[model samples]
Target: MGFDARFLELHAAMPRVSEADAATSVELDYVHFSVVLDTARRLARVTGVNVDGASLVELDRGGDDWQLDERIPADWQAGPAVYARNDLDRGHLVRRRDPVWGSPEVAARANAETFRYPNAAPQASGFNQSKELWLGLEDHVLAHASVNGMRLSVFTAPILAAGDPAYRGIRVPLRYWKIAAWNSGGELAAAGFVVDQAPLVDTSEARTPLPGEVPDLGPFRTFQVPVADVAALTKLEMPELVEADRLPKTIAAAGWRRLETSADLLL
Candidate 1:
């Protein structure tokens, strides 16, 4: 009931935190995914989920409850306190519906497991508008995989840069990264993306907020980047994914490509 490294025809193992932070990191397994929490930072360093598009279950998100995993100390996670009375939304790193597949019982469990605090990250509420394009990337990729066995493996996490703004005892990440993997005619194919909300986030106010003031956030800028760039930005090991990247070297050399719609995707 956890992230399966062998889910894809070509193995795409979960990303690892750096050696310096490894000791303090806690790996937690959920229904169909796993989260590696950076205890010191009180946030997830990386998460992975296996997606089966053809067998997806459409579960209603009526309850929408969030809870701390008892397996880890509550302080190890960014709980409700970090998001209360603020514009920050608890964004799911693994994406709630991505792992909701298989039998009814199993699918329901996967849905509830997504609400765990370890799977969430702080994101601007208004960032949703721009996030539409970002989220659509997942749908587009899934649709592409549907024709080729409808399976995918996804890895995601906040950049967790050292310069992130500290607020409510936790640092708010300004950037997030996602990578999607699928089998393309017997070979592994991958696409990587990085989403930035730094322009929307007023870190100065966050660094020194008045008693009730929170960081101000606006829109998000999404970019389709090279897998190597994602590894460099997050300091994670992903040689296999980097080698499997579908982005052309010419396009990657030019720089991160901005995406206004799914049509802009090179994949």
Candidate 2:
């Protein structure tokens, strides 16, 4: 009953992505899987930030609800230190709820750097609470790892996605993940986490670490595809803009891409 043997037996894909590239370009240093932020963005946009006025912190922190751990990489210690006094939570792009999640203490380390004000934004409680749904996404894919199999990243970051009325234009990428299934067909999701940019700031400076926080490689994106789909996860859009925004070019320029951006060719 362990995960698909292919996930363990298959050679690790090319390291096509790096933690930095995602924040800036499509380039990366490692490639265990592929990604697609456009889809998640579309979902977020449609779902909107309708948390009923609750806070992200109040949402269930998995409370040991997930099956995996958020491994804390040595990379986090080398980056800008975050200020704990700030209200930001160390958010993970991949959810701990995932049955295949790895590491626990490290998982905790992979939190959204909300401690820093530069990365504050409004998010729907449902988005934060949808842990089960996200995990469901991961479960399906990992169970059948194949030629096009992929794994979600555990990187974490600050956000500025829409839901927030404060940081109205900031979007924070994350490493949190939850697997998703779109059909009985062969297609799989390319991304798990969404580009949540809460409405908040106006600083020209990208999110920098505070007095006590360091750069964490925790916040990252995820992807799911067939055993053979090698194309990139193209930018998808909300149903409202699906036809008009096929590639979701705006999102790509803003910091979100889709699985179609590249195929499962994580090399």
Candidate 3:
């Protein structure tokens, strides 16, 4: 699908992005995203999504139905088989609610687009409470949207590292990252966060746990870090977004701020 030019206006401006290695771009109706699948790893190099808050709707969550994007070969994307017997959840890269705003029909189409496997990554299903907090990061920003013109764009994807553990022919990423971009007083602004599920995923080839072992492997942690760090890790062109980070300029001099609640966010 061709990317919508208007979607570009909804996000923080950026430098011309160099093509990622063996990347595949899939642009949805209201949500513009790109999928760079690592066929060997059976996962995405990065799935970048741009969402417009003004077009969002308050619809009830859709049925958790997942499908593969027919535009791409079925084998190129991970299927339910990889997640079936594991604790890994098919987590959405582009949040389920972000694009579901707009007219009823438009909202429905965008909602369905979010279910494609290209937009999902394997995440620790055990981080329930922490996941809720991570999901609400945009809500916290949306709260201030009314005053800031209701414009918001978020970029998210798993940190696909080469050494990630392989399972069922797919390598499960240990961490995931998100950057919320918006306009505050006509100035571009953004905040970066990382969710580490390392403690929760057992990447070892042998999946069996010892008898009588506890199943849960949390509590996961989320931290607010510098946008430059996210750009460095994902190797995407985020110069403008990095400059838009809401953290103090001296943040890198310090360290990533650990977040326990939405209240800890800078907005």
lDDT of 2: 0.26
Report the candidate with higher lDDT, 1 versus 3.
Answer: 1
Q: What is the Cα-based lDDT of residue 187 in candidate 3?
A: 71
Give one digit per residue, the lDDT tens place, for model 2 in 28-109.
Answer: 1111221222222211111110010111122234442221112323222211223234444433333323322234442233
Which number leads on lDDT?
1
**lDDT, candidate 3, at 123:** 76
Order of quality (TM-score) = 1, 3, 2
Q: Which regions in candidate 1 have their CA more than 4 angstroms from the true location?
A: 127-129, 145-147, 200-208
lDDT of 3 by residue, 1-267 (tens): 322323544445422234764344333333454555555555655554555666667776668899987876788788888778556688888788776766788778777887888778887775466678888888887884432656566677777787666666666787888887776776777889998876555557435434433233345588999998988887777788887788886765689888887777776
- Candidate 3's C-alpha runs over 4 A off are 1-40, 48-55, 144-147, 200-218
The stretch of ten residues in a row with the least summed lDDT in candidate 1 is 200-209
TM-score attained by model 3: 0.83
lDDT of each: 0.87, 0.26, 0.69
Question: What is the TM-score (0 to 1) of candidate 1?
Answer: 0.94
